[model samples]
Target: MQKFILTAMLLTALMLAGCNDNGTGPKKENQPGEILWVEVPDSIQIPPPGKFHKALVKASVQDPDGLSDVDSVYFYSRKPDGSLANKGLPL
Candidate 1:
């Protein structure tokens, strides 16, 4: 009897799971997830000790309605050491 009641409740929950009130996507609206394009400098006269200079870093390109749109662009470097103790090394 307990198993039957649990099964019925699960089925009811699954049936109601299709109801979405978020208008179909994220609050910002995007056909797909944003993309981040990163580019680093090739040659530098003076490179920072703990920094990898980045020439271009395109972030969060979105498609509002199946159309490509450039949302935000940023230029920065990623640390190879994976130690985020210091976040500012200049790019």
Candidate 2:
């Protein structure tokens, strides 16, 4: 049950963490970086109840300007209730 909840939260967070838009609509020259792919485990195992489980998540991004133009990539998780996690951990 815990694993399922965690998985759902992770998926939701990723969906919310989509690329940023300038708000003026799509411009070819002002296009933001594209997320090539993301990786996450199908299932995660937690040992003792209080013990924390470390899940690996990775994302590959590309920018029209260049890799240097990319500022940063962050990972944040959502709560089971579909809310942002404790102010969101920018990891």
Candidate 3:
């Protein structure tokens, strides 16, 4: 019907109006610096289950600015409730 067509057109217009680029969305520009870590083991086997385990992670970092921009690298682990645990470990 004409009413349904008018409603659809109004909705389409409203959607288009709401979709204006405000530049507040996710950054579209390439970052000046980036860090990429090497592929790690899928899972490490802990022998005694409750034993303390340690791992050495390696990464390759690139920066168009300079390495001085990077202060420190931190690592994090997820807890049982789905939140990050232990703040972060500085590398």
Candidate 2: RMSD over Cα atoms?
26.4
Q: How would you encode candidate 1's per-residue C-alpha lDDT over 8-44 as one tens digit per residue? A: 9999888778667436655754455355554445435
- C-alpha lDDT of residue 62 in model 2: 88
Instruction: Name the runs in model 2 displaced over 4 angstroms.
Output: 1-30, 42-51
Clashes of each: 0, 0, 0
Ranked by TM-score, the better of candidates 1 and 2 is: 2
lDDT of each: 0.56, 0.76, 0.68
CA displacement after TM-score superposition, residue 55 of candidate 3 (Å)? 1.3
Cα lDDT, model 1, residue 48: 80
What lDDT is reached at residue 44 by model 2? 61
Off by over 4 Å in 1: 1-33, 36-54, 57-62, 66-76, 85-91
Residues 63-90, candidate 3: write the lDDT tens digits.
7657886676665666567776566543
Candidate 1's error at 62, in angstroms?
4.6
How many Å off is the CA of 37 in candidate 2? 1.8
Tell me the deviation in Å of residue 17 in model 2: 46
Output the worst ten-in-a-row residue range by lDDT, candidate 1.
Answer: 53-62
- Could you tell me the TM-score of candidate 2? 0.50
